[model samples]
Target: MGLLSQVLLLPFAPVRGSAWVIRQVMREAERIYYDPATIRAELASLEEQLESGEISEEEFDRREDELLERLEAAAGVQQGGGGFG
Candidate 1:
């Protein structure tokens, strides 16, 4: 940016910095959320819960579907598609 523009926007620097930090955090969060290994671990945990009778079969099915969707979304992202949709 030009010196004049930088000076003019100096007052908003903190806000801009905060926004950038938030964006970084969101990107990291999404990375972790859609990670295949994480999803697989969760799926295993869900199975253990079912086996231990901690969750009903219906609950297991619902959660399994959700995890499978995450896996699909992760795969799509890896293939150059973006976002959950």
Candidate 2:
């Protein structure tokens, strides 16, 4: 953009900057949410809760399935495939 174009766009600079920040935050959030280490730690904690009777067998089974699903998803994303061609 030329000087005049930049000057015209200056009025919208805050909106553009805010959008970029939001995108970056979402990317970081996704990275953390599917992190393997974080998932492993949570799985261990879940097991502890189950062994201590903090969670019933049914609930534990349900949560275990969810965690396993997340683990598989993270692996799939890392491998660039989800059992699909």
Candidate 3:
């Protein structure tokens, strides 16, 4: 952009910067959320909770299904098959 354009847009610089930061944070969050290792760790924790009687069998089954779906979605994304449809 020319100097005049930059000068005109300078007033919005803070807004632009804030938007960029938000995008970066969202990307990082998605990366962690879809990580296989993270998913596995969560699964282990869920199992522990069930074993300790912190959660009922029904609850465990529901949560396990959700985690399995996430794992499957992650795998699909890794294989370039796209995310949950």
Candidate 4:
């Protein structure tokens, strides 16, 4: 496109990226803090994929546990008032 259009799009790129990041964060917050079954189901599917040779067991377990731990920690932090200042 035009140079002006490209320049304008440059600043908006980060905003768009930030919005996508926020969406993901919100979904994670909901899964970890409100509805945990989403995490469990995703983990189960990951484990199944690993069992079927779609992914390595080490990677699968590592990612699954990491997600679980992150969610649990987020839940704990929420209970702790989220360190608001």
Candidate achieving the largest lDDT: 1
For TM-score, the strongest prediction is 3
Per-residue lDDT over 18-50 for candidate 3, one digit per residue giving the tens place of the 0 to 100 score = 999998888888889988999999999999999
Model-by-model lDDT, in order?
0.93, 0.87, 0.92, 0.75
Give one digit per residue, the lDDT tens place, for model 2 in 1-85.
8999999999999999999999888888878878889889999999999999999999989998998898888998889853321
TM-score, candidate 3, is: 0.93
Between 1 and 3, whose TM-score is larger?
3
Q: RMSD per prediction, one decimal?
A: 2.2, 3.8, 2.5, 8.6
- Could you tell me every candidate's TM-score relative to the true structure? 0.91, 0.86, 0.93, 0.47
- TM-score of candidate 4 to 2 decimals: 0.47
Query: For candidate 4, what is the lDDT?
Result: 0.75
Worst 10 residues of 2 by lDDT: 76-85
Give the Cα RMSD of candidate 4: 8.6
lDDT of 1 by residue, 1-85 (tens): 9999999999999999999999888988998999999999999999999999999999999999999999998998989967532
**Model 2 ranges off by over 4 Å:** 81-85
> Which pairs clash in the backbone of model 1?
none
